[model samples]
Target chain A: MARSTLYQQVASELRRAIYSGDLGPGDQLPTEADLMTSYGVSRNTVRLALGELVNEGLISRTPRRGSIVRDRRPLLMYPQRELTPQPASVPREAFGFAVSQEGREPSQVIEVSIVEPPEDIAIRLELPDGGLAVVRRRLRFVDGQPYNTNDSFFPHALVRDSEIVRPGDILRGANRVLEELGHPQVRVVDDISARMPTPAESSRLELEPGTPVVEYVRVGYDSDDVPVRVAVSVLPADKHLIRYELERR
Target chain B: MARSTLYQQVASELRRAIYSGDLGPGDQLPTEADLMTSYGVSRNTVRLALGELVNEGLISRTPRRGSIVRDRRPLLMYPQRELTPQPASVPREAFGFAVSQEGREPSQVIEVSIVEPPEDIAIRLELPDGGLAVVRRRLRFVDGQPYNTNDSFFPHALVRDSEIVRPGDILRGANRVLEELGHPQVRVVDDISARMPTPAESSRLELEPGTPVVEYVRVGYDSDDVPVRVAVSVLPADKHLIRYELERR
Candidate 1:
């Protein structure tokens, strides 16, 4: 076999082990020297194989620790659930609800400010030229690990006196505040796309190389069909799965 | 300013031109010599700036045409439309309908076969351990350009005698054939994730380097809640956008 094929063979075996649960999350693989001795290949081949696994987001390599299998269990997000009426017992937002369902702690750091929104956000919100917006930016975490980011924008004129302009968590969620303002969202349109992370996103999310992110944008409209809010979520592809269940109506 | 900042400045200017429609699809960018002289930067810096645009899927580089802006307008996909009833004038599938709505030609090359599916697919289909499946694989195109790939799998026992087992296109779509077989899909669960494309997918889809793909899997169930079909679509992220509209019920 060609030398390239040899490295690929090693990678495939290790990938299989990870998928089969033989090598689990946080479980370290054999050291380079041990792998070389067992597979009868050079250290270069072992490194190449491990590199492949890292690029696939199946494993991570650190200077102190050898290659360790990563946690591949993704959080399932039900986008449709956002519009559903949540029980009063569940007071948190959709992200927190999903994480707590998985028995993980959820937290976030948020900053609220008013500024001229970006062109894309302006377009989605149907803002006129030079229209201002109040943006609530959040860096969310699950179990103390940064998971994703959500930045929601609302028309400044509409939410100037609302709780959304405050710099803190909305225990009842911003959607509820919108309802109290007499502009409850009756419908929403979600757009999903994916791409490689920008440098800023990579550092903020601590993503490994070759990791992509899903950019989900949802624009909520009130009863009068006026766009009220635009929420953009950047989810690490390896850590989240967006799901939608539809029934024929 | 640092050298890195200089290149980024150049990249930002070019990006603005593209987004602002000053540089359109198939429009050739300034040559390396011209860029170097205009920006008063080294040829190496010019290459780096152009490389960034290529990675962003905004431009393509070729030996003959140099660098040209790519067509970045994505096709809007409405997943909910599949479950909604279509008019008699629209005889094609959801994908074909969406493309034609944009005034673009839609076409596909299909291959049909029966085989043991991959483990993940089997689990989704709830197939017996040794059960077989009939797969209708399609390489779809828009305006004669390679766009995406969709592979729909049905339980072999259910579609063995159906048109899904034949080797040509289903003019009316495979979903209708399923309905005729007394297994109309009443509900569906869609799972959306993103990742770097495998070498095989890269070649088959003709994707650019640094481009990721949205892996969309939809499991359709009959009235009895038994999964009747599983469709997997590999969409190049730059070329497609999946949208969902939800109403509060």
Candidate 2:
């Protein structure tokens, strides 16, 4: 076995300190100079050690903030567990962008007011056929790059009549709008598949032939197990990483 | 709204059929001619629909065989509650690779050997300090591309001197070997994180600058939470998709 690097040893020591509660979350680790003096390592070595810690998601370092421990704390919930969507005291903003998306994007090219969801979505939402539902389709881009196209279905009775569902800002994030409407998502079930991108999908996503694109069908439900929205997103391969954090129950 | 192509409608219908169990897993779907006749669509349209099904992991098509239904079953067992490192009939071959990797074709590399685990892993494995463990590192490749890497740590004493421990053909995967050795996995806990890849990692994985990687730390254990192996996988953004089938409990 290769001898453990000096930086690795430093990283392990710091990690142990954090996990042992000697360094609490939000606490700052010693500065480079202090670490250098304490560990008799160079500035570069200290930086490398700190970098490893940050990469492990154990700490976050900023120019002004130095190196403070990160919360590495996310709520652990099962993917199969029912999550209730309720209003949040504070709205959370999560960014979605393709690597190649290079400018202002998430454009809304087409918008149509619909009275009902298609049979498939209606069945998933458990809504009656012809029931009022808003069907919105948007060709989303990030940084001027065409990335994904979203076709989102929401029950008209849920938000169709609200201003949040209107034309001008319908181009914004639908999830953000949904949160403001008192249906903060507590759970999201995403069913994903992949295949060669279609000509249209490929062109929109700027994918090459045979390049796989991941397709996700996301269902958002209320605490009552009532499906609120069914959304579809397609991402080009080489651009996105879908993540899910599972906690031991 | 523009009328969707007939092939899309057919594809969606077929998907719904499978999801609803109208077409059971491993059950062959109707032939393209039958589908064309049933939907009153062209052979091309039916072929397109079937192609989409294959991409979505819903069906498999082979020579002299029609599109056979796939086991679109959800392996959504909770990380907190699922049995692991145990004697079971579940074969590792059931899980197919999203991307093809074979031979020594420009893929990531992982070395297998025996070593001591970190304190946390040692404690979980019910071993004292300096306890022996089998360590395996795998470099992942996608279409001849270097993409990700994994390092798995197993109880060395438990697996040492075994064919599965010396980097040879693991007749069965790690757990299967453990079971044959009279230790079965009962549960597994996973820690997941996301961060920017390191310079070495970025270069080795052929990741573009500024690309982030997702890290997964999984510890498979026996019924008593005795950790058998702890695996750490670093997946690049460009080559992988992680999916979860959520069920409301």
Candidate 3:
């Protein structure tokens, strides 16, 4: 195996320190001059090492602040679990349950309205052209900080008078309400991608500059293979990690 | 519903044109002055509307070239298919197969070596302290363009004499080789996250300045409940979309 270069070796050492909790979030790293002097390396090498940490999202460099370690604690999200039946004891929505399990306070502001769905969402929900849908839009917060947004669309004709059309949180989750309405989702398809956030999303989530967001979309189908619900989530890349487990059948 | 602002209205028109392919990839958008005149809005509104497209990653701006639509063709990846048995006629690896299915040629360069695995890989593979592993590192390509990188690691003691120790591309895939050697993977766990690319990765992948990368890690376990393989893939965020289908049990 080829040996690692000087800059890589330096980066590895700093990474180990950060991971081992020797250096923590918001802690300032040694200045470039100090690092060069201590490691017997050139200024370019120290800069390169620092660049690696910046790319890893472990540290941020500013003209005034130099290099400060970033908060690397990402919330774990199980996309698979969101489709399954939650235990009766856990009545909160998936996001709220997950955050509360981590000992974080979870809260959300919701607004519901009926409108002609977007083109992509119309196709996902299999609504007719010009068909209206009830959309429940939510901006979720963790410990009083905006974390993410979730927007779920349901066919207006199917859920016109249902609780889904009301402007409030569904304490038992909208999925359970779907089951009670005889449109239980038996299958779901999820698509995940990432990109820079729009100005509205950035302001809503209070995102720092250079932060990207993961767009997760799920199309759920009933037992008869009829598309019932379409959920779109925008999760800040720095604050969320998605996980899935698959077993061979 | 509240009406959209002037800038938002402008942005929506442009977004609709792009989505409808009326303004295709590489097509130049109207200049700020032209948009201001056409929409009967001020230069600030035009600039804000343009900023919206930039943040959405739908266009690029340069001094010489004002704004051009970006290529939005993302390679779709199914992480769940990697562990499943391939059809009798299709013997290629999951990545290769997926690319080929999209009517694109797939290729890769492989490098094999034995070394002590990284701390995270060691823990995932459940290797003892200081234990070594054989890693097959691949730089994959699509239609002659550098696409992504996949590194697969296996316990050295478990496959020392197997074909996995050699350097050439495994036409039947290393997973098949593992099955032949009595360590078929029966379960797998996938983790997905995104961050900016390191300088080396950016150069290697020939990525643009603002492109982030999705870091995907998968751990495979054999029927005996022993970890057999750990695969890590770094995919450029702009060039990949991951999808999964789930069913209620």
Cα lDDT of model 1 by residue, B1-249, tens digit? 112367678987887787566898999999999999999998766766776676456788887999999977576788888998788777888888877765567899998889899766776786775789999999999878889999999999998888889899887788888999999999998989999999999998899999999999999999887789999999999898888988988
Q: Is candidate 2 or candidate 3 better by lDDT?
A: 3
**TM-score per candidate, chains pooled:** 0.75, 0.47, 0.74
Candidate 3 Cα errors over 4 Å, as ranges: A1-70, B1-70
For model 3, how does the per-residue alpha-carbon lDDT over A124-206 read when each residue is reduced to its tens digit? 67566578999999999987889999999999998987899998989999999999999999889888988888999999999
Question: For candidate 1 chain B, which ten residues in a row score worst on lDDT?
Answer: B1-10
What's the lDDT of the predicted structure labeled candidate 3?
0.85
Ordered by TM-score, highest first, the candidates read 1, 3, 2
lDDT of 1 by residue, A124-175 (tens): 6767668999999999998788999999999999999989998999987898
**The best candidate in terms of DockQ:** 1
Q: What would the per-residue lDDT of candidate 2 be over residues B155-207, giving only the tens digit for each residue?
A: 77777766657764352466567667776765555555445667889777777
Better of 1 and 2 by TM-score: 1
For model 3 chain B, where is the 10-residue window of minimal lDDT? B1-10
lDDT of 3 at A222: 90
Q: Which prediction has the highest TM-score against the true structure?
A: 1
Which scores better on DockQ, 1 or 2?
A: 1
